[model samples]
Target: MGVGRILLNILVVLAAIAGGFYQLKLKPILVKFGQGRVIDPRGNTDCTTVPELKACEKLVLHQPSGVVYLACSTQESRPHWLPNAQRFNATGASRTDYVASYNPQSGKVTKLKTVNFNSPRGLSLHGMDVVASSSNPSELWVYLVNHREPLSGDPKVVGADSSVEVFKTTLGGSTMEYVRTVEDPLLLTPNDLTGTPDGKAFWVTNDYGVKTGLIRDLDLLGRATTSVVYCHETEGCKYAIQNMHGNNGIAQAPNGTFYVVNAIGGQLTVLEKQADNTLIITDVIESDRSMDNASIDSEGDVWVAGFPKALVLVYEHFANPTKVVSPSTAFRFSINTGPNSFYGQKFKVDRVCDRSSYTLSVACHRIT
Candidate 1:
């Protein structure tokens, strides 16, 4: 070998010897690498099988806390999967409409609180809190469940319908106030929902109980508007929707395309806004059976977390899926949802109408 080559080989050998010594006497250096890991496609997580979850419904990841809070339906209460579980006897909920929170970073739970829900169903995680929809009290009603842990079990009031109560979150604590309810144009006997990541609007859908079709629209300021599509109805444009899972769980793609799940429709549908800015379902993701609520990661790998037989299913692309099954799959759920936090920025800013809320005028001195 040439002198340089000999020197390089000697250096490598020396590094190995030194590394060994350092590992024994000093801090050891560790390196992490990624690989292709195989997972089972058919695993079940349910009260009957996994015995951890009583029933899994809406699931979501709260980025700030690095946790996954799932709304579950149980025969009696939130199951043994969590230690400190909370239960709300939603006077209208079937004893299964309680909320549960878990930390994905540590794979442990921090808090589990229940909202007194009547007909409580769909659940989603927002910022650091939880939003649960229930008609326990009224028709135009939806309740926002906060992250607060109460002192003890709060008995669910019987025959109570407090859906008109609205909620907002602050750094200090959770606040519940009343907001005017808009008429239910969609006739939402709601199934699933997802608010736009931009925090501008939200989408809710009912699983087509009537031929009127599954509900779809934007919730802006408590005002619900059925998407106006036909150009003749608007300015002479015909609108069509495709790529829908038929309203299983409304999930936003990492790049903003929306995917629909049927949960039992046995299909994962995808929807996109047209170039003309009208909405349409364009594609459907399929498997041996219907898929439920799904979450997409930065790599565009879609994770369908759900049940009958519970599974954490993965796909290579939204349109095409290469099945990935996690070993922990084995739960039966009615509905499921989750998110993969890659990296980005999340913030809430104060808005001021005027340019100079506080003026800063600098005094300058002339220097020669």
Candidate 2:
């Protein structure tokens, strides 16, 4: 064979190999882009007319009066990857990190004037009171895994500590009052929390380990080493559930079953709290979408917020918040309370909210 022909053959082989690699590796990511296409909840093609719900997380439903409370953080803040970051380019902008209430009967949302904090993530209501995890930069540290130098001399390096802020409210009232703040080292990266029946204790989920930045992402994507800590009034905090893959939301059912959502693992871990205060995984419900925070209704129904296209939605939301609205779904399921085994089936999924605003939670308040 001629040398020219051999060279042409080798080039063609290399091109074919590159094409195969692109199809095998990069095609899936490309395909995921279309998966995040916003679906009109009103069954229409135009999404501009669709109602926009406030970006919220850690919803807690007060069953007595049918009031659903959620943590809404609508302000543009610094990037988690950047150390000692500040809110830039926002001249007259203000942070809307407060607790909001949804009235099912009137179909109205009322922003409560109670506890105001920066970057409130997880929330839970105990009777007439509520507790939320405030993950401000001062309370929560976002270490740059790639950058070794500390963020020294940065004036915006404030609130790098972590704490759980508590608030008091009425069962069906629209007003609230700031109570106390629980600061602890065990609450590192607290994602979600739920109060006990007596309101004397609570459990918060630490989604990641001490390692931040890229290493924490890899840990969440692989073997999750985080845990759920039980914070008691007199005993401080202790581990209740361990080895969770991005444990985001937690809710205790009326029957004492604990429903924990793993964001990275895309699974709902059903746990049972023993008499000794430890938790045992009873069942696990797998999901195609990445699950966030979850809430349990009085009737034992589970409501969860999930990202249909996790990669695309997350990327688009962080990249261009105005152009690409993150699409999310509210999933509802019922647990089959059997004698020995526990299982659940997803009964419904409502795509009524745009997660581009960063909707991180869902809850249902059933009126008796």
Q: Write the per-residue lDDT of candidate 2 for residues 125-238, one digit (tens) a residue.
A: 211224322432111110000111222323233222446665555545565655456767776666667775444577777776652444564553356687988887678888
Clashes of 1: 31
lDDT of 1 at 274: 58
**TM-scores across all candidates?**
0.42, 0.67
**Cand. 2 TM to true fold:** 0.67
Please, what are the lDDT tens digits per residue for candidate 1 over residues 1-368?
A: 79999999999999999988756533311100002323333322211222343344555554333444455444333221111111233332343244445543344443343234233332222111133333221111122322221224442311111111133222112222333221232322234445432222344444433222113211111122322221211132232332232344555654657655554444456577556544676655444333345554334444553332222221111112122211222112112232321232111111111111111010000111
Which 10-residue span in candidate 2 carries the lowest summed lDDT?
139-148
The residue pairs in collision within model 2 are 137-159, 137-160, 138-159, 138-160, 138-161, 139-159, 139-160, 139-161, 139-162
lDDT of each: 0.34, 0.56
* Number of the predicted model whose lDDT against the real structure is largest: 2
